[model samples]
Target: MAASVQRLQKCAVSPTGKHTASVIFLHGSGDTGQGLRAWVRDVITPELAFSHIRVIYPTAPARPYTPMRGALSTVWFDRLKISQDCPEHLESLDSMCSTLGAVIEEELKAGVPKHRMIIGGFSMGGAMALHLACRYHPDVAGVYALSSFLNKDSIAFQAVEQRVAAGQSVPELFQCHGTKDDLVLHQWGEETWSVLRKAGMAATFHSIPGLYHQLSRPEMELLRSWILAKLPPDGP
Candidate 1:
């Protein structure tokens, strides 16, 4: 048997024929962007039917996972062991942030306003989404993190404090996690929310009972509503 090859790709959906707001979907570790397309199209679009928006899903580069049986798959960063936080992880964080920033810039040039852009992802991608939204100085509309862990708590806290000192208003955040999620756990989400709240950031945290590491249909519905709420109406 031959090793499977992976590739990075992008998909866009614009139902009203023109783009008004946009949502960038980042997939979880070991998964391709294509995995989340049907979910978004089938679940999110109908809920926000009135708004004409574009959804972008981008795949990450494939790499070897040393922590998981030397598995070759796509990940925003190399895997970290359970309950261990490493400062060295910041390097991968910076790389993903840079890539995501470039994608946002491209969308802006194509006509999406900074205030109408929503950055979101699942698992590792979710962590990257939240990290970038907090550090990136653009007028990001919102951020959604699903079943993800925050990397480098000290650095993230410091960044929040610095932003507050500099008189910057943090973007709104929606964080959801399964109470039974062993991979990241609910406590991680609570801690992240605590830090955000202490810094006066607009944040909402939800714990889905009995859910695991995956998203549920109702959760997707909630996300759709949350995204639309952040976007302005089609007309003034």
Candidate 2:
């Protein structure tokens, strides 16, 4: 295991003591797993309330973020900039993907089927989810990204293309972005969804009106519904 993966901090909620399915959500740039601890405890735990589901939030190790002039920050991967025009830093992104892949492998070893696990995140975390799910773990139940965008010519697209050629299953994607988002422009998210569909992935894009870069209750509620839909409880 890489040093970064070894140092990953994770927060989990498994109140029902059952692990029939799992949801691993990633946090945005500079945010740790504990950063989302409160939300998972207060909001997500109650909203989903599935006795068989387990939720895991993993924190990224602190590293030099190129967008911030190399200042250390907790980011899944480094990028030159957060825009469709800027080319993605594939080297760093691939490294982080491998690290995250290790995390997923742990879950699979724990008895969770690949198709019963869902992966998603917010902002940069969402971008990482896309890369991980699309390129590395295409058999996951589904993937969601909030207030996120992908650069043009992303490896994710290429990976999906190869999957299509091989007749392999590709997970569905649920992408939600606020129209008022300033940091990650809404247009960028929209374009990313468009490109994802063009790449032969089943993607749904939800536009939240009058919302900002931060998450909103309404968006999360919708996400909760999507989650339950994708990972319904097992039959008795």
Candidate 3:
């Protein structure tokens, strides 16, 4: 197993010199916060260009991943497999949600309102974001997931159901998946969206034609627009 990063490699960006909103983005399995930060700097930051928006990239702790035959990886949680048909690893998921919840709690302590925060990520990270937005921090402004999916019986769905029954609002969801994605199939993404809708959350799905299981500039641009719409700058 490779050595793990003990500290989070947080890439904080506030373009306008003040932070009125935050976007916490996580990277895929086997990747680090530093890797995601580089991509955000090269792709998302340039397009987002919002001064009040502070983008944070957090790395997951290294752990033995079940899907990878117990090999160590920086994944939010363990999984039997990447397929939606596989049962979730609730114990690992619980721990990670608590870990990420602390991260959001820190933002709250810093005076950033929960409604002004957006949680998102790519691949496994995206799946974790969905779990957070629905199960742990449903009060967040929004959530965006790229090339991700959730099982039909995810804890997130149960949380959404309870929240809706209590007349509580849930964060809106924005999901992007490439139609040509073979790793996390497009059908799985669509099924996840359907489940979310049935669970009483407002969601949108974007299909990238001819694309694969990777990020694209157009996807980031669309995400920029969605983020702006969700938490627009306070004033001129």
Tell me how far the alpha carbon of residue 53 in candidate 3 is from the true structure, in angstroms, after superposition.
0.8
Candidate 1 error regions (>4 Å)? 1-8, 39-50, 152-154
TM-score of each: 0.86, 0.92, 0.92
How large is the C-alpha RMSD of every model relative to the true structure?
4.9, 2.2, 3.7
Worst 10 residues of 1 by lDDT: 1-10
lDDT of 3 by residue, 1-62 (tens): 11221345566666676878889989999998778877766765464467788888888988
Quick one: RMSD of model 2? 2.2
Arranged by lDDT, best first: 3, 2, 1
CA-lDDT, candidates in order: 0.74, 0.84, 0.85
Q: What would the TM-score be for candidate 3 when compared with the true structure?
A: 0.92
Q: Which stretch of 10 consecutive residues in model 3 shows the poorest summed lDDT?
A: 1-10
| Tens-digit per-residue lDDT, 1-236, candidate 1 | 11222334776665465667778889888777777776555655453343467777888887666578668878877646544365536766676677777778777898888888889898878877877787874368888898876744546567777887899866788889988888456787778777877877788988888888887877887887798789755622
lDDT of 1: 0.74
Where does candidate 2 have its weakest 10-residue lDDT segment?
40-49
Error of 3 at 70 (Å): 0.7
